[model samples]
Target: MTFAGFLGLALQTIKAPRDVARLLLSARLSSEALWTAFALVVVLNTLVFSATIALMPQDGFGLLGNPVAFMVVQAAALAGAVIAIASIGRAMGGKADLAQVAVLLIWLQSLRVLAQAALMIIGIASQPLAAGLALGVSVLGIWLSMNFIDEAHELGSLFKSAGVLILALMALAVGLSLLLSLLGVVPQGMNGYV
Candidate 1:
């Protein structure tokens, strides 16, 4: 697809998530295309993360103490979530394959990264609006993903798909927290999240 086509798809994912999910899941990409999209999403996410750290105020956070590790963990968690959802979703009679699930997740995440980049750019002009939309962005992302996943899988009900997604997220969160704690990444008595 051309650059304009990709951007149009991304906008559709935000504005009309179910429709976007239909188109995205219907297109059969070769393994090369799938991996290319995956790599693009990861690289873009990393760049956005790096820029976020660069723009944040430095108090006790030194340049060396960036959340690069957290980003790695985040990526792993997303991959794991897709696997679990696809496997369990099949058992629950959903039709989306693993490749479709992975592609949809990457597309959803790319939309989020784009929204965050826009928020950061707009923050330069209006802090309050940016701050409000920052929270909105998080909610909207989850909503979009919930709808996208449901549509892609032909999952019978929105509520059921959302429940599955939420459960997957909780599992990942707990698993990551446990793993981090075992590694002494998150010290005891403090919040478990990065």
Candidate 2:
């Protein structure tokens, strides 16, 4: 797609996400194409992340500071989210399949990378403005996700999409907690909190 097409779709995602979701679903991207796009977005996100860390070095990224490890975690987290959306939506009687969810999520992630890049550049000029824009993008991301999920699953309402999102997030949190516990990554006395 040309830059104009990309910008148009991105704007549409913010303006009319359900329509964009429908358009994406209708594209019927092949599984291979979807996976390739997913990987590309994940890598792009990792690159953006590395840039962020370089620009504002933090105290404790630890394992995540390693680019390859960060990419692996990023891919896993994204894949898990796609699976959760598909599985939970189906369990809740919605109709979207894994590939359908994956495509929308991959597109969203691609947009997120672009937003992060823009925010990084803006941060170089004005930190407070960049921070405010980041907050706005986050809220926009949540709104977009609700619309995308509703359209993908034919959920028929933003309320249902919100329900699905909540459930998926809860599941992911519990699953992550369990995984960290299993790996003994949770610090002593902090297990309950996690």
Candidate No. with top TM-score = 2
Q: What's the number of clashes in each of the models? A: 0, 0
Q: Write the per-residue lDDT of candidate 2 for residues 76-116, one digit (tens) a residue.
A: 77888898999998888799999999999999999999999
- Stretches off by above 4 angstroms in model 1 are 58-68, 187-194
lDDT of 1 by residue, 1-194 (tens): 77798798887777888888878777877779877877677667777766765775434433224556655665676777788778777777788888989888878777877887888788768879989999998888779878977887788688878876887788778777776666556453456464
TM-score of every model?
A: 0.83, 0.91
Residue pairs with backbone atoms closer than 3 Å in model 2 (clashes): none
List per-prediction Cα lDDT, in the order shown: 0.75, 0.88
Task: For candidate 1, give the lDDT.
Answer: 0.75
lDDT of 1 at 55: 73
Angstrom error of the Cα, residue 141, model 1: value is: 1.2
